[model samples]
Target: MASTIISKDKFQFTDTIREHLAFGIVLTCLFLFLTSAYTKIEEHDRFMNGLLKVAFISHYAWLISWTVPVAEIVVSLFLIIPKTHKWGLYGFIGLMMVFTIYIGSMLLWSEKLPCHCNLLIEKLSWGEHVVFNLAFVGLAAFALWLIKNNQYKSLIKQNDKY
Candidate 1:
């Protein structure tokens, strides 16, 4: 019998699987943001109300509630193109982290947690929302790592051709 060893960086993903996973991560984020943007825009006042419960002040909450949807739309657009995908992923990760913190805080500190207005996430309990956001964070991180490694591999190949 022969024993084989796999490298840690591979994470058991073949090149094709890695590629698919990367695309899936990007697309999933894009879909999530696009749909969320639409819902937020459609239910703008409700979103503001939800934020008001979470935020310390109403005006600041209003501002955030408005800006968040626009940001989501922009991030979704940027994520589709290869040139902007890295930055999009970075933004996605940051946003997810912020959401995770916000949800976690709501669960811990807030006496009355605000209901979310987004489609799927809106319905989830705070703990479930945290888990969902954390999952996205992991996906974004993995996508980033995969993209960087692919670039590194390409660069090495180019050097070898010299």
Candidate 2:
């Protein structure tokens, strides 16, 4: 019988970097995305109401609102999981795209509506909002590139041979 050892180098550089980047991005996004909710815990109801209006307030609104933070945490964990992280990264990219669009649309559509949830809106403007969204788009693009690269082929083959 022959002895063999599996090592981290078995995976291609692209896959390794993407996997790590995906995990990092998920954590960063979860923290940055939910920051408003965390900071405005005092106004949780208003925050929920805003989302409810955008997403339709049905019987599930109450539960969904409360679970959103928890759900973000779960998704972040999934992105960090070795077996499930690839697919989870794809989902994370999609989520970021949707959020970018949603926030951008809101900014464009509302010219003078009273800001509800953003605590530091007095310092914000339409341009700043767009710039913020653009930053998210850039991050999403980097993550998406990794997903499309398909960098695991080498690692998978190396493992099979070993």
Off by over 4 Å in 2: 1-23, 33-42, 49-71, 111-126, 147-150, 153-162
- Write the residue-wise lDDT of candidate 2 on 3-121 in tens digits: 23345545545566776775576566555545544544556677566665653333565675666555545656665566765566566566556645656666667444334334644
Question: Measured by TM-score, how close is model 1 to the native structure?
Answer: 0.88
Q: What is the lDDT of residue 97 in candidate 2?
A: 66
Q: Please report, in order, the local distance difference test score of every candidate based on alpha carbons.
A: 0.82, 0.58
Task: Please report the candidate that would top lDDT against the real structure.
Answer: 1
Badly placed stretches (over 4 Å) of model 1 are 1-14
Residues 108-142, candidate 1, lDDT per residue (tens digit)? 87888777557967778778788888988998999
Best-performing candidate as measured by TM-score: 1
How close to the true structure is residue 135 of candidate 1, measured as C-alpha lDDT? 88
Instruction: Please provide TM-scores, in order, for all candidate models, with all chains considered together.
Output: 0.88, 0.54
Error of 1 at 131 (Å): 0.7
Residue 84 of candidate 2: its Cα lDDT?
65
